[model samples]
Target chain A: MTSAVLKPGLTPSRVLIYAVLILACLMYLVPLVVMLLTSFKTPEDINSGNLLTLPHVFSTLGWVKAWATVRGYFWNSVAITVPAVLISTAVGALNGYVLSMWRFRGSQLFFGLLLFGCFLPFQAVLLPASFTLGKMGLANTTAGLVVVHVVYGLAFTTLFFRNFYVSVPEALVKAARLDGAGFFTIFGRVLLPMSVPTIMVCVIWQFTQIWNDFLFGVVFASGDAQPITVALNNLVNTTTGVKEYNVDMAAAMIAGLPTLLVYVLAGKYFLRGLTAGAVKG
Target chain B: MATLELRNVNKTYGSGLPDTLKDIQLKIAEGEFLILVGPSGCGKSTLMNCIAGLENISGGAILVDDADISQMSPKDRDIAMVFQSYALYPTMTVRQNIEFGLKIRKVPKAQIDQEVERVAKLLQIEHLLARKPGQLSGGQQQRVAMGRALARRPKIYLFDEPLSNLDAKLRVEMRTEMKLMHQRLKTTTVYVTHDQIEAMTLGDKVAVMKDGIIQQFGTPKEIYSEPANLFVASFIGSPPMNFIPVKPAGGRGRWHVPLATDLGQLSLPLAAGDADLDQRELILGLRPEQLALAAEGDSAVLQARVEVTEPTGPDTLIFVTINGTKVCCRLAPDLAPAVGEMLKLSFDAGKALLFDAKTGERLARESKTPAEGSAGNVAQFRGR
Candidate 1:
């Protein structure tokens, strides 16, 4: 009776398709279910029960300890990811508007150079970026990590926004110009209002990227300024400690929850924005 | 109302590339409607953009009220344009789109509301003021686009094929509305379109352009009746003007083309042209409406077999062979002819135009259109 299933005599291929879809969904969600169950269990319960079993007498010891250990660094992650996402997305929108609309000589070559940055490996810029950060006396600080994430995230954000804005009619810009709107006014009043879907995609993408980033966080920051990802890794891999699997699961859950929440809340818009060009109005 | 003039304006995208607009010259009187018309890739739209200051001309001056505005930006130039796409701001309501320019100029809030009200009422879009452009139909969007321009009392208006996107019924309705609006406002306006019907029905002055050059600039009647060259004559008519290749028969500024007939070839006398026409072949230009069914035992009629007949709602078309060229004659629907029947067609000898076969220039340059009291018709016609 459902609308989406393949109909008309229930062919063998349809059954095979439904089988594969269900199997893939379980494969993805199995580890997440295990992590959530373990995070709510005691050390004894985690060791005794299997990955799929419910907790034997629920406990809060792992979550409390994990929260105590990573709360400061969790706040540090917020400080870094929030500013990086906002600044990078804002700057990318402006960059895209200028590059696509008010083009001058060599703008194409300049955009080509910017696109080159998108494919460059993060390891390729680690040394030079660190040296520059050191020269500016921002090394080993949360500000340094924020700067690094913003710089690295700009390539994708600009790409998303530029591709989105190109579909907008150029006549809109010309009409606004004839209506006496200047550059920033046109961008803010005319263009930006129509960019909500793309903005959602960029924000969701940058939140997940910056939140899960280990390379920039571990390299450019340390000590009191380390983000939650670095703290989670430290908690899981400490050499002179007991192997607390429950605590490690709780910490991992803490580090992964923000991205999960973003995808769950705004996932449909993200998919729509990605496939916007596939079908036209 | 304002007078707009362009003195030898030229535009090129790059140095070595061919010019997109070449040495354009136009002078429009106060409150006159000038229509720039041509096929696509001609420089009519480019000329409109230059007048709106959206594009910078490579050379020459644009005079508005006899003061040069070539260096000003689009906002400073005080001109508004309606794009062919009706580029209504997708994010703004109709009222806000109409009020955008006035708000940018820092007009008072009360004055801006009044201006928006006046323009919305004039365009009959007061019902759509609260809705977005995407919510309206194509014709409604077109009205909102016009309202956006009319809200600003600029010196001149530039319309770049504003009705080109509408359906046939809507385009005709909007065309009549456009004429009424222009008459009521009496604002200096320059419109661009490739539709020859729009050029004929809506312009006080029309400029037909091709290949970055103004082919002919005159009134619509002059453009229709007496074109300056072969391109203008051919491009300005529906079903097009027929051109027949013929050899001249006489000399001493009096020429006639030899047309092939059933009995034999007959000399069709045209206006007096120079002896140079007799030295080379000539192209005879005639419109479909100019030819009619010959009366019984007409002395000067050309005889040919009707090859095909098309019965349109208003008029029937008769196709016949004239000097080995297929020519169409428009007749009353009641006067339909059968195929393969012998038909005699008579045309006004004086209305026929002669052009050089090689150069496409009009041969009778000195002849002008007849005045109201004069019996002189074609021999006294003037050309650009």
Candidate 2:
């Protein structure tokens, strides 16, 4: 495969293409490398050295400071993101199964309306959402943030799952039905098992969306319930005697790490899911 | 085992649209293999779906063992269907696919395992039990699909063109395998296919459908030799039955159909003495195999210039024009006349059929001497 891609002999054009690809890779990695380097530097090293240089004195002080400030909100993000991802994903699977397989009157229209949610601007709904949450006495709670993320994330998750299930032959459903499987039985025994790729896509998408969300997190949650993104912003914006650039970078990395870890772990499935959803849809 | 029946079954897409299936009536005795054969858009698949209760009938009842199952859900109907696409669950291993139905019925784990093993052994797919469907070849997947159905002893097995996706050679092999499996199980089965050869060979009873209506329903031999209409005659045979236009030839109580050749016109006598045959347009149908090279002393002989010849290995097909209608005659390869050669062809009038040209309906009603001693024909048409 590599020989097929590279061809037998390399021409100047091939060399040029390789040069451009390497340059593009370095361009993308520069910021990440700078962030890592900055997170390892002591405040004195950061002050003395250029941003790209290795720390003159490597230290754990930045990480310790960042963790002290961000740990509670990191747990809050976990508390909010996990249940939100699970509920939305489950709801998406059910919606996808019904819309694709067991369709009834107005199902297409119902799905159309659900898909319309994907385009609704969060800014436009944020005020009304906050008002409703306050009326329901769920404002400023992790549970409220969970509800917010799940509701907002459902459209995308359903789109992923519906497109995936649509590619599955309807004959499988009919065969299962004849095999004495009812709705849930067919979903559990047939549809769900075939859905690992799409589920991975949805969870990754929703996890990243909910975990990285600052607007909803800052607006709907506060103090003890604030997610890492909101907490990081507050920590970085605090007016103080001296700015802790290393701590801010460390804090930002901490805020970003779960999604990065998720992608790193399941990145192959993430890509497969996207392309599979595209082809099927 | 079950006796399956469709009574006045009708299916229409909606109130304004035409019916997709119209007044389909059929019966299959216990362990009988019924073949529903038709071209695309002929509702053969729809009838199979209706019988499986996957599609609801707009008008009538479906019965199994004399009990109406039209209202029952597909699962409650005790029917298993093998689809054209196989529909094997891609996520399941072969064993799990075969065991799925039993598991759904909440059968004990041990029994399910035993049934899966039995089916795997029966289908010769025991080695494939650990592999997912995507890992297997098409033929292997087909076997696993059959195993899934065979794992459960449903009242009936419905095969909707199950062999359609296989290559021609594998289809023939699987066709025989299907017959052998059915013989061992003795399950009532309904198979749908567009292939006339499968219809003829696999069916104990064959239903030839056209435009959502059954054109003919009879034993395979009966359908072959004594078709009910021009459509049935044309649809059921390979290289199809030839239709020659004929008009009354004389005023006497005799009728002759005209045949054309480049040399001259020849005439053949029609055995039917019905008065309605006079001064009326008619069509005479004869199967290609029924027309042969004329030998010395053959009674009904006509000379024609061969237009084309196709050698199909087992037999050569000779094409000639009769009354301006192209006629195909199947004959032994050695005796096949070359194109443009003058040839004498003889057709037995006893095996010939007549139909009303306008209505396309069969005109003559006479007892045809059964050429082959096929069991279904003997039992179903003995009195006729």
Candidates' chain B TM-scores in the order shown:
0.94, 0.94
Candidate with the greatest lDDT versus the true structure = 2
Model 2: lDDT to the true structure: 0.88
True contacts kept of each: 0.93, 0.97
| Model 1 superposed RMSD (Cα) | 3.0
| Candidate maximizing TM-score | 1
Model 1 chain A — which ten-residue stretch has the worst lDDT? A1-10
Error of 1 at B34 (Å): 0.6
Give per-residue CA lDDT, model 1, range B1-384, as digits (tens): 789998899999999999998878878899999999999999999999999888999999999999999999999989989999988989899988999999999999999999998998898889999999889999999999999999999999999999999999999999999999999999999999999999999998898999888887778887788777888989998789999898887876766778995545668876764545656878999999988888987666887888899988898888888887899999898886798888778878878887878778776543543232223221122232
**Which ranges of candidate 2 are over 4 A from the true structure?**
A1-12, A277-281, B366-384
Tens digit per residue, CA lDDT, model 1, A1-281: 66554445677987899999999999999999998899888888877878889998788888899999999999999999999999999999998888889988998888888888789999999999999999999999888888999898888888888888878888999999999999999999999998888888999999998999998888899888999999998888898857888888988998888999999999989988887645633
How far off is residue B313 in model 1, in Å?
1.4
Q: What is the TM-score of chain A in candidate 1?
A: 0.94
Looking at candidate 2 chain A, the ten consecutive residues that score lowest on lDDT are A272-281
